[model samples]
Target: MPDRHVTRSGDDYAEAFSLLLPQGQAWPRDEGSTLMKVVRGLSQIWGVVETSASKLLEIESDPRITIDLLPDWERNWGLPDPCYKEPLTIDDRQRALVQRMTIEGAQSREFFISAAAYIGYSITITEYRPFMVGLDRCGDSRVYGDGTEPMYSDTFVVGSIPVCNPNGDPVALDELSEWPNYGLGPDTIRHYWTVHVHQARLTWFRCSGGQCGVDPHLRIGLATDLECLLRRWKPAHTEIIFDYSGLTPGDPMAGTP
Candidate 1:
């Protein structure tokens, strides 16, 4: 077994005190004597220093073994976790600290999956590649016309335009009260991936780790932490779609690489 603390010991304090005494005038080294009282009083200061040093070692050992320094560590790590912000329990704070201890900035699939895990979500990633070979970087936007909409046919609704903001009333021959000024190239489907979340992050009461009224286990809500984290860290060129169907991938050919 290991010592739980470091103690300043082995007669050093007492011996030094005796050394300063007049030569051959017997120093009262026994308990409860005046010189003994002085030695013990001096040892108290050393004791406090030793105890604090030991606690510092324990705190530096791991985030979970923290003492009064937990809040300080969180501040240094820039936590209160910008992604999730509901829980304020000891367990939740400790878990957040552990997650942040090893976090490295990344954009890999595995990195995002682990990031979601930190916020108690189960998610899967799906990658996409455009099947259109001649598509340039400035690809066309997809307008799903079934060859039946007014824009795809000669059928006309008066003052109707193919521009966005279809519901707005027409301002002029071809203008609308709110017409979109620009278009997006490479429709989202071609430049995006989807995150299929399998279940809600539901927390029930726990017996092993529950506190009387503080352990933050009654959670039941659709939290946006995972979505926020993923969106913030995803590749700049890629977009993200979230599926809350709680079912397998509905895409016919979707497969993990």
Candidate 2:
């Protein structure tokens, strides 16, 4: 049978109790009667129980509500990510599991931005395209440095994709500091792009949505959690260079260690 819920007040419970008593006994109808007071007290006790039951129901299913059952929810969702640092707070864990379950996966810039937002990072995607003389302006950067050389698609050999020489004699995709439009190797410009990761901002906790003792102390949490997810979900044909040039030079990127 399904749970049939009914919210009742102390007065309602008292009336029900009064009905249970034997009709032979003369029960006082006045609110000041001793029996009435005893009944009201008992009824109010059950009111506390009712309040607890309602609260339990609210927290039972929603990941955001319950803190103790987070492990169970994460386990069921295949979370507590072994590869990355686990979230420090209850809010972090809940957000991770919730996002993981809801994200169906997509191959678009917007999808990645929203996904990164869930991880607490703001990002923008920059796709690289070689300049075409007829379409591009004079001030625009050219793939061949001066736009004199004709851009042609290089043959991609299976399992033989060229790699930058370790000794630096011949440069590869990211050997140059600013990614020189022209490189000595095959044109892999189409195979690469930049994801500008914005600087982390402070999120203050408010009483409305903030969990006491939880959100107040909660920082922006971790950036790697989202970075790893983005890297994992990116299309296989291309590579992404994370540009964390928010305020200063952020974490290590392409050419850097």
Candidate 3:
């Protein structure tokens, strides 16, 4: 019979409570000691209790008071203004999932759809504008606009097609490419795209048609357009899994270890 050996990395037992350690500091040498193990176990239990309590408290707590309790690092990590953030990516499938998972009163479904569409529009335009215009005329058109209004107006030109409506069906690029002056000069396609994204963002986050109400904490601005804040649309702090992991120690959560 062949010999078999089982091995476990220290990270295998790690829990969210472990984040209590300070950043850049190593776990104590006694970290694996019996007492420390008990502490770790208790910390994990406390974390679950804490999370439940927070959710319950959130129902009645003043948002401002709750905001005050967040760690300074989380508060300061990204751009201060929502208007400058990039749009979140839009995926109908993901939005459906969000609807199923969250309470209906939260209206998370609409939020997901709007955020995704907004971000997807931003990314698509940011990346494909040069290709759509060809490299030569790319610099001729304005890349970034002052955060006042959408770059493209309703009548903005994109070859033979006039982008008459920001929320209309997407124009086919093949048809656009066949136009006589297709890539010869600067065009307003990028601006039109921004308008589409802006509309989505506004629908999701705005409390009133022209006023702010809901606090979108996860949204961070990469830049801005006229009346729209561009934000990264993806979920914040999602962990990407990598192969060959037994256990990997992560950064500490709080004060020095």
lDDT of each: 0.58, 0.58, 0.32
| Candidate topping TM-score | 2
For model 2 the TM-score comes to 0.59
lDDT tens string, model 3, 1-257? 11122222234334444566555434542676664586566656555665555554662132222233333322443323344344332222222223223423321223433443433322222111223522224233322222322233222354433221122323332222111123323544222222223221222332221123434523333224323422333223221111122222222221010
Query: What is the Å distance of residue 225 in model 2 from its true position?
Result: 1.7
lDDT of 1 by residue, 82-174 (tens): 777555455556677887787777965667776775666667665554344333224333233433233421122345434222222122333
Model 1 clashing residue pairs (backbone): none
Q: Which tens-of-lDDT digit does each residue in 1-257 have in candidate 2?
A: 13446656677888889888766447775688888899988899777778567556666467764665778988898988764563245555666677767889997676787776665565766665554444334442322212222222222233432222212122333333123243334457877867877745234454434567555543443456656787898999889898876633233221110
Q: After superposition, how far is residue 86 of candidate 3 from its true place, in Å?
A: 13
Question: How close is every model to the real structure, measured as TM-score?
Answer: 0.58, 0.59, 0.21
Q: Where does candidate 2 have its weakest 10-residue lDDT segment? A: 144-153
Q: Ten residues in a row with the worst lDDT in model 1? A: 163-172
